[model samples]
Target: MKKFTAHKKRVAITTAALVAIGGGAAFAYWTSTGSGTGSATTGTTVPFTVTSTTATGGPLTPGGPSQVVEFEVTNPSTGVQRLQNVIVTVADEDGILWTDAGGCSYKDYFVSDAVFTAGDVAPNGGKVTGTVTIKMNNLATNQDACKGLAVPLHFSAS
Candidate 1:
């Protein structure tokens, strides 16, 4: 009985070794490699320009009506881009009344919504025009502080 059990264990070990060796030999015949070449293309970048039709605005009086500032933007990209929105930054060349000493707040002077839909500028070259209306605060507090103020308006689009 002991001899028979030893013989069975030996047979199992031999069978596993044969299966592993056979699997390895099968993969040995399947071995080859190849190479190829191709070209990679990239998208073209578009050029753009923004011109202020109303470059200089002033001589404005307090409690005045809205001042129309026009802007023309050009999109020269190969891809189509729409006039989604306009962003603007304002600054006074000469120092004006500080916020602590402020008479009229900037929000009071300028219209909150200055951007208008100017439509889409075509790709490869096209133009879109928009307007920003600025108004002066009619408050007496802003009378002296905002006098002869030159606020440079910077514009950007997404």
Candidate 2:
């Protein structure tokens, strides 16, 4: 048993307070903020080319023969290209053409402008093919408006 003085008492109290504060800090969560440099790059674009286009039964004779159009497409991408649609259109041609019997083909006709379903084309010199059935007007007599007009065909894919 030693004598407790006011100074000693004060020092003891201060030490106790410091210890309590340190204990509480140990149990508390800490947070810090920092920053760093970063970068984001975009992907490259792929090129598409139409290799060749061919049509069956040229110089189309009305009510004569059913015609067909076939074309080849190429993808120069590094990854596979998924095509959603292939749009076919006739240009520089004559009168209105239809696929029905009284139209171009009595046996076949185009139900839609888009002839292909979803398909994957290989990447890097990869090739894909598509075809469509077409016909000129099938009427009582051949109209001069639908003669050998050298109508061009256009095809595009998504």
Candidate 3:
């Protein structure tokens, strides 16, 4: 093996130490801040009517098998538009909803901000309000199912 010069050895050791220290620091940050779980910065602010929000679905016991979120969107602008996309998330938890494709339906499941838009709000008397359902897997086994799920229904006239 080729022997490294004294200076070269010292430099190599220092670089290795720096890398180790950097990795440790990063790990510390992740645990301390819990920043990856639904960081507030990820939510999109879409306009829609603030209808009633209800938790549906899930197992049958005290716990349950899934959860459903229902909301209403009113244009009030008297225009005729359609609602598009749905983005639902839970804080500090995985997203538990069904909305992979783009359109208006309460059957598909998954987390999405997919584009819930309502466009035809007739001048001052146009409005649309409906219920959207979100399903959750075995809530009993997961226990921490709906921990960090936040759903903001976004829509526009189409």
Best by TM-score: 2
Candidate 3 Cα misplacement greater than 4 A, ranges? 1-46, 57-64, 78-82, 91-119, 138-158
lDDT of 2 by residue, 14-60 (tens): 99999899877855678999999999986676756764456666556
- Model 3 lDDT tens row, 1-158: 23568778889999999989987784333435344444454433335454446556653222234455565555454344445543444322232333333322223223333223444444344455545544533422432333443433333223
State the lDDT at 101 in candidate 1.
40
> Which model, 1 or 3, shows the larger lDDT?
1
Q: Candidate 1 or 2, higher TM-score? A: 2
Candidate 1 lDDT over residue span 1-158, tens digit each: 99999999999999999988987784345678999999999776554567777633545677765577787778878777777777554533332422324443454465435466655778866777777767766764537766666545666666
Candidate 1 pairs with clashing backbones = 46-77
Question: What is the alpha-carbon lDDT for the whole of candidate 3?
Answer: 0.44
The best-first sequence of candidates by TM-score reads 2, 1, 3
TM-scores of all predicted structures: 0.53, 0.55, 0.32
Error of 3 at 129 (Å): 2.6
